[model samples]
Target: MSKKILISIPIFILAILSPVAPIFYFGLNTKKIDANIQRLLKYSWFDELYSTDKFRHLFFANKHVRKKLSSDIYVKLLSHHKKTQEKFYRFLEKENNRSN
Candidate 1:
């Protein structure tokens, strides 16, 4: 292969991937957090942890999660706001604790 073509191939691939990179990167991180949250939701420990103010602040800082929580049509339709808020807060704390 020519030196120029060899060099260009990787660049070309990156160029194609770059536009979608942020979405994929954020998606992966969100998935990690979501998995931890899902595990936490299965337990009762979340009930106590979510009631604190500290947890609420950090939990909402994550824009992706915030958007998901606010506009989740399924959740809105099916859940009471207070109940959903409790669940969301619990998930956030779970994900935060997992990161540490």
Candidate 2:
């Protein structure tokens, strides 16, 4: 009886802690994912490709497509593109005014 109680106690403790394992795993994965994303974001070619209208259309066209794009990462890329485009247009406008 004592041996059975000892085995059951460890088993019960393990069952209780099992759910926490995935949470820790995912937390570590999230950091790695974020790091990889940041590295990818630094490339100009990646920026150009992500900024295209076709990419935007495909990203928003369907659930499966959006999932493939990893919506969170794509959204952040789109936002960065938006800000960069705005800055470029502002610079162009300033240049045009100077030339006038």
Candidate 3:
């Protein structure tokens, strides 16, 4: 009975592994996925990704992965916007102070 159990376990494992082998093979070839992500970043269709369904879908599909990606993109954009606004306000303030 012990021998029979050992033999049955190997057989069961092999049977399960064979069917799932293709999935492993496909996942191992990750070049396509990397390329797709690169393309998405480089050629962003929307001026702001925050409002796009694709960006929102990415967040919904995988929160942890999307959080890092979204934060980096958002930070850069927000920082640039803040800098521009700061410069504009400084210019206006300087002019106002000069006239006084």
Candidate 4:
């Protein structure tokens, strides 16, 4: 029992951390974080885990592996993504406005 508990502890920790891997991977790169997240979110598994499904039927979630996340997770992810893209998006908007 003791040995099983010890072995399972690390596995549990890894399972929790694995879903948010992209956040850790490109966190430091502000210049590319938005693009990185945009790409990662297109993957069904990753997007479901983060609960960024724009359409319910689009993301095929595996309930057996893990329950789908709540909108809170998506909200937080969107907040972070928007923060990173703010300057770039604003610049684009400004350029379009000036041209018009």
Candidate 5:
């Protein structure tokens, strides 16, 4: 094989695989944490650990922080998503009135 072809092949492969590593790692970690949380949800201290204000803000507290970005940003994203869903659902609701 030519040096140029060999070098380019490795570079292309590396570029394609580079992003997959972190994505796979984070995805697996998230699934494991989810299973652990679900299995432990019945226990009282598990709930307490999640509710404790002191520990809740810490990295290892309530749940495993699974985002590639900061957990705060991830939280904000989830909150926004929830609010948007509420608005969408609210639009479909009908109010009752005594008079026409």
Candidate 6:
């Protein structure tokens, strides 16, 4: 009886938690995925590639893909790029000031 109860308790716990496991997994992975996407977007070639209609149609045509990319992801990538550019300019300014 005790053995059966112990086994059932863990099984019950597992059943309860299984559905939520993906939420936690994806939550942890979201940042890594965002960083990788941002790194890829930082390249000049990526901008050129993305500018082409073929590339945009291939990747962004699907409704789900369009929604995901056009919404938060696009905004986040633009903001990340702006911030990186700002940092670069600041570094350049500091170097110029020091030289002068």
Candidate topping TM-score: 1
Models 1 onward score TM values of: 0.37, 0.34, 0.29, 0.28, 0.33, 0.33
Q: Candidate 6, residues 11-80: lDDT per residue as tens digits?
A: 9998999998765664334455445446557666556545655444433333333333444555455446
Candidate order (lDDT): 1, 6, 2, 3, 4, 5
Worst 10 residues of 4 by lDDT: 61-70
At residue 71, give the lDDT of candidate 3: 44
Per-residue alpha-carbon lDDT of model 5 for 22-98, expressed as tens digits?
76665535554545445444555445544655434432422223231133443344335657434422322211111
| Candidate 2 stretches greater than 4 Å from native | 25-27, 39-100
What lDDT would each prediction earn against the true structure?
0.58, 0.51, 0.47, 0.46, 0.45, 0.52
Q: How well does candidate 4 score on lDDT at residue 64? A: 15
Best-to-worst TM-score order: 1, 2, 5, 6, 3, 4
Global CA lDDT computed for model 6: 0.52
TM-score of 2: 0.34
Runs of candidate 3 with Cα error greater than 4 angstroms are 1-5, 16-31, 42-100
In terms of TM-score, how similar is model 1 to the real structure? 0.37
What TM-score does structure 6 among the candidates reach? 0.33
Off by over 4 Å in 4: 31-100
- The predicted structure with the larger TM-score, 3 or 6, is 6
Q: By TM-score, how accurate is candidate 4? A: 0.28
Better of 1 and 6 by lDDT: 1
Quick one: RMSD of model 2? Answer: 15.3
For model 2, how does the per-residue alpha-carbon lDDT over 6-100 read when each residue is reduced to its tens digit? Answer: 89998998899898876555433434444544554576754564466544343234333334234456535544686754554354345444545
Clashes of each: 0, 0, 0, 0, 0, 0
Residue 63, candidate 3: C-alpha displacement in angstroms: 11
